[model samples]
Target: MRRVHKALWWASWCWPGCDNQAMLVEKNVPLQSFNSFGILAKALSMLRVRSDADVDALLSNPSLKAVPKFVLGGGSNIVLTGDVKALVLKVEIMGKQLVGETAKAWIVEAGAGENWHELVRWTLESGYPGLENLALIPGTVGATPVQNIGAYGVELQDRFDSLDAIDLVSGQHFTLSAAQCAFGYRDSVFKHQSIDGEGGKPGFGLAGRALITRVRFSLPKNFKPILGYADIEKKMAQSGWNAAAGAPSAMQIFEWICEIRQAKLPDPKVIGNAGSFFKNPTVSLEQCADIIQREPKIVHYPLVDGTVKLAAGWLIDACGWKGKSIGKAGVYERQALVLVNRGDRANPVTGGEVMTLAKAIQTSVYERFGIMLEPEPVVV
Candidate 1:
């Protein structure tokens, strides 16, 4: 173990102005259990942040503040390349409640560390029903905003209200509205790095600089289920429910989504994998039309904006990658979008293997379809 500096040691003890109530800075911590991929790695220094005060306490120490920090949420959307040398702040903040209600919607707030799926379930059970389409999505609340996570027919930006975050560099607590988040398809300001514009204007990006503390959602009071996805439609047909006659309740939609996801996606606990390795690539109508002419069976959805979203899983399966393995990494047989660790706990897949397979898939897809698949997971 590395020796703790005097200032760091003192700050840990003096935080919150109480004895034995210090911020614990763990060293050489094993991270296999922390990450959903089950990749074996070690954090040279780690801190489990349970509250905003913990961040304040960590930032208060100059020695700790100067070191590079990595904010880890549920670890569902990251690929660790190797042992992390930076100080890892594992967010564990927890809480969820209805903050306010309006004629238009009900405002709900959740701690960043809260399980995203659990939060979705809570909202529905508590009578707030907007998050049903996103049921069974992995990762934490903090991570959801970062990726602008979406499923079925709804995206996070659809329900996002605002979020609280602490600036790691400035030690400033701040809040951002949905517009400020700049949510895109599986992307947000948090995924980008700061950049300077043409005229020395500041560009928007919060990656590595902001530590999300809490997130607020605005679930519409007049609940309307977002349907039309093939999976949901199939479920509705199976249950003999017609949208024209009467729509299913929010709970029903949630249950259907859960079943759909479970059938398609492997549970991270049972199988070492991340959900949806690639974003469904979007292309212009002309490009989609050209591809359609070449390959009539290509799975695609037409977006309202005159663009087409191509199903990445279908593309991978088309390329004959399904049920195939490259070392310890393999494309899932059921859903080619997911890459799994074929190795057991004793000899798990390395991040290198995952990336190698991902690169090969990207190359193959790009070469065949002229569409380069973008990986969803952040490589750390």
Candidate 2:
């Protein structure tokens, strides 16, 4: 195993066949600190990819070419069931810059490994206010498009420009437009497995085969803060700002979102959690009406498309899971949608325990509401 110092990286990349040109492959890397859950796990082999060139070099290496790989980002949205057997490609790619601008929008691009919330802040601080509504999301920029992440009245697809990714199998660098990504609620092409088409043509899905390198967001020139959610409205009322008189600034909305989230969700640093444990289940109007008839106080939001999105937290709370524990995993007291690690770092909750609690919650919610809650985190 060849190891090159950080200072020598540029020199090694510049000079081919250098003794230190081999990609750094760390062995038996502990992953407790890597994942938000703080579950104990180890990656047998790991590589920190700083750039697409590093990915190309990794693929060209005969020893690593055939090994299965996991592209890890902030590790905030995953649960480790056990030690990872595949080679973990930890994305450390870092950069954020104003790429370009059009008449209506300012285009900003950030490296995949750049922190998601930091990017939102940087964009706002840089005089781009479109991303302020998505403040405090925990993950990498790469994971944003993959998950179609959204908050308050804005979704990533609303501001997405395009993204750069590397095809893991062909080692081909490609760019995807928003349409090509096929973004949906908490899903994109990246979340599904590739389908085999006739004549060996790729059908749909890029899961496990594409590594996102950079994400580009289009911030509108005429920025309007997204304040449709009840939480934001409550914040406005508390602040004595009348919506009819004037709207809050993007910065104010950002701060309000930060405060709202802080009050409701536990900090992952203090309490191990993967943010919202489940996706808010969407149902048709008739179905929602039926459920509403049984449970008159069910919290739901009607979408423009006539579908109703129910609050998963309310369902869980109604099922008596809030602040409840199963083994080392527990539902967050403030927000029942969030599952937390009730154990300390030295005795952290296992992935099995988290899933067990989640399953129990799902069963309870389903029995009560007739809606099965889907988990948001990817279980590894």
Candidate 3:
């Protein structure tokens, strides 16, 4: 095996190409520090794969086949409850490309393991404008499609073109177009389906599914930049962005998004968190209208499918869960959507505190607005 670089560690595993006598920490060890949410969990056997060959090598391990296996990105959008019984594979490779760029537009490919917001700033610094509004989004490039991650009125599918993914089953590579990804509001095929086949073998039915190593974006050229979000448009108008529209670079939008995010969400570094805890629940337009008739100030976003996306944060705040504390866990005071770890307590914290608050928010929102808030991270 070639020398591989990985910042995280996982549990030990015996594999074909690896020397059984000498074990590399990067290849297999418990990883409690890599995740932002700070769950101390040991991967039963882990492998941080920098290359496709390393991924294949793990697949070839018969010991890993019968036990569980999981593909992990930056571990930003996950809450690990216990030591993962599965072999957790953390992706750590990085790269970027100006695949195509016009005077006013550009397309780029970002490595799956690259920080999402850092990539956005990179695009902005290089004068590529579209990604600024998405700055500071948590997680890696690979997981973007998993949630079709969106915020402040923009989504990954909006600028997405195509990408390649290895089929964990066939051990072959395939490309997926934006449409083929079956992206929806905060959803994609990967979210509903698992790489491990429940109906078949270990990696069966995993077509365009595996570890996503690279993501290609088809960003706009000569397009009207969106002052799309109401609050953002208001801020931009105040900043004289309307006076010199094209002059407001991606960095401007990046700063705006960062300010908005900082104002709401707690810094994950200071307080362990996985960004937004719940996804905005989508209800039928009529249902939203009914809620609005009762409250008269219900907020919603009109979707193309004619559904109304209700703000999950507003619902949680209205239910009085904001700043509610339980042991070492508490909801963020400023943003009802974020759950924070209180850091100072000796309380035996199970990552389940995130789930408990999520349930409260979910139940509260459902009772108040008839909308069930779906959590963004997989709780296990």
Candidate 4:
């Protein structure tokens, strides 16, 4: 392959008479450090995309056009089972700017590869306050919309403006509004597989098809703190704040959230983990009442739609999974929702062990509560 630049270049697999423009590519890349779970794996071939030009060039390359590709973001929400055979596109695109402001909202955009927590901090420091409730979230800005990431009482869709993405198959550029993206509880259209010939058109899912390039958030100009979560309310009480008192500043809420998250969740850097291992299972009120009759102390919350959301952590804890280890994988002691790698770098937890533990937890929870817990991380 002809060299383009020192930093980025085309892969040796380029077809004859291919364009000379260099695209960054690496072979047999180690990926233990890439995923939050610290699972050992390798990518047969990897490409680093720094701009739209890179993606365009990649899609146009004859040799790579037919090869299967995986769009990777922050690597915080995936589990690597083994070596990746598909070409891995590691998005390193980076930029953030205030796009515009309207009468009701401030529009700010960030590249898909930007660190999510850092983006939250940047917005707060730059005088944007609406994202404070999501502070300290791990992963990339691109992954946020895919997961419909939320914490405390604020979700990404609640502050979403729109997003720009490139279709991997058709190489078409498009923008999707919040409604078009179809955000759900810790889920989105991007997480599901599209059905064929459904509804006399294409199906609803976008998983593995679209590459998010940039995301814009509509932070409201009239921001009010979201303090309905129990932890935040406890903090408010401890700080001597009452209903008649003024609302807490965004910075204060941000600090409190950071403190609360740190105390409950294990840092991926220190202890290999994927944050919450499972999504809290939701059930109908009648089903919840039945479960509650058998287990009166079961923790649950009533949703706006009359569904009852049960704490997966509580069920796991009640099953004696807390602080329990299976091989090198274990459930976190402080928070049962998080599965962790008990081994260090020399002998980290294997993806198989992690999945095994996860299945066991699911079986127990289902048997006890009649609720099947779904894993949050993508299993590759």
Query: Which one wins on lDDT?
Result: 1
Of the candidates shown, which would achieve the greatest TM-score relative to the real structure? Answer: 1
Task: Give the per-residue lDDT of model 1 (tens digit) for 1-380.
Answer: 87865323334356656456766788788888888888888888898999998899888888898999999999998888899999999999999999998889999999999999999999999999999999999999999999999998899999999999999999999999999999999989998877665676676898899999999999999977788788889999998888586878999999999999999889999889878999999999999999999999999999999999999999999999999999999999999999998888888989999999999999999999999999999898
Tens-digit per-residue lDDT, 197-262, candidate 3: 566435312323467888988777654556678878777777777765565655677787888788
Quote each prediction's TM-score. Answer: 0.95, 0.94, 0.86, 0.93
Name the 10 consecutive residues with the lowest summed lDDT in model 1: 5-14
TM-score of model 4 (CA atoms) = 0.93
Off by over 4 Å in 3: 1-30, 101-105, 194-209, 237-247, 344-348
The runs of at least 3 residues in candidate 1 whose Cα sits more than 4 Å from the true structure, single-residue gaps closed, are 1-12, 196-202, 243-245
How well does candidate 2 match the true structure in TM-score terms? 0.94
Question: At residue 116, what lDDT does model 1 achieve?
Answer: 97
Pick by lDDT: 2 or 3, better one? 2
Can you give the lDDT of residue 156 in candidate 2?
99
Residue 135: error of model 1 in Å?
0.5
| Candidate 3 overall lDDT versus native | 0.74
Error of 4 at 262 (Å): 0.2
What lDDT is reached at residue 46 by model 2? 86
